[model samples]
Target: MSWFIYALKNYLNFSDRARRKEYWMFFLFYMIFVFVFAFLDTALGKANSMEEALDLEGLFSPIYAIAMLIPSIAVTVRRLHDTNRSGWWILISLVPVIGILVLVFFTVLNSDEGFNRFGRSPKAEPAF
Candidate 1:
């Protein structure tokens, strides 16, 4: 819970480092929110067809994602910073088949052993 809020609090902050825990925890809560909204949209809307239900889901789904977009980008950049990589590395995700794999690899890699250009180790202290 605190992790989720911390991510939001720094929503626009792209500088500094973000620990793996901070990144993954925020994503966990974000996914939970998306699932809950999807469930509600489906159950309450009572659409007549699959298409209609999907439309309802689409209507509500974008809201959460849109709200979180900046924070998501900021955290991903910070996460790259933690790994001692330029935030521009995130653009690798634009590549075809291997793009997502490369991004995941970047995120999962251990943070730099010590400080680099970005900042000190996020693991040395809590992200918040």
Candidate 2:
């Protein structure tokens, strides 16, 4: 779907809010490609040395970075939705180790009431 492609195009973008569906869908796409590439690399070529396989791992570096970034960004926005704060709160993680852990906890916490500041409540079910 275009959503998945859009996510990939913005792979390196850290800003801009993302809806839950967009995040999950992109993740689904990422996993599919990861499996495909890993399988193809292993099946088509024989890397006799550990170093050779290590080289293949390098090929995955950029994709891995995006895979990791998308979820982080999505979760941050969802967390902000819960607290009624803006997604910018994610920047708190830059504070230090403790901040990172706290943000993680906050993000994983339950979505807040009807709505706060980051638009409608994330938990609200859509009619569609």
Candidate 3:
């Protein structure tokens, strides 16, 4: 829960590293909220059919998606940075199925030890 809020607070920050836990928790809550909003839209009669829902004719889900878009991209870029990759790697998602798969593979990788170029690893314990 705090992880999700942390991501939102950093919604526009793309120059730092993010822990895997931070990235995944934010998306987990993001998906949950999307489903909840979709359900609310349906119950409120904003969406009358599957096609309407899929098309984002509903009020809540689409607005939620729009609001989350920047934060999502920011966290993903930070996640890529944690793995010592350039944020521009996110452009690979445009390639096709393989592109998205490659991005996922990159994100799932452990954070680079210490740091390569993108500042310190988020996983590192603070020096006392």
Best by TM-score: 3
Q: Write the per-residue lDDT of candidate 3 for residues 11-67, one digit (tens) a residue.
A: 999999998889889889998887788888888899986457547789887898898
Q: Please tell me which predicted candidate would have the highest lDDT against the true structure.
A: 3
TM-score of 2: 0.50
Q: Rank the candidates by TM-score, best first.
A: 3, 1, 2
Q: Candidates' TM-scores?
A: 0.87, 0.50, 0.91
Task: Name model 2 segments beyond 4 Å from true.
Answer: 1-57, 67-71
Clashes of each: 0, 0, 0
Local accuracy by lDDT, each model? 0.81, 0.57, 0.88
- Number of colliding residue pairs in model 2: 0
Per residue, candidate 2 scores C-alpha lDDT tens digits across 1-128 of 67676655655544443455655666577667656655555555644333543455534533555555765465456545555567777788888898789776665555556655555663465412
- RMSD per candidate (Å) reads 2.5, 5.5, 2.4
Q: What shift in Å separates residue 27 of candidate 3 from its native position after superposition? A: 1.0
> Once superposed on the true structure, which residue ranges of model 3 sit more than 4 Å away at CA?
125-128
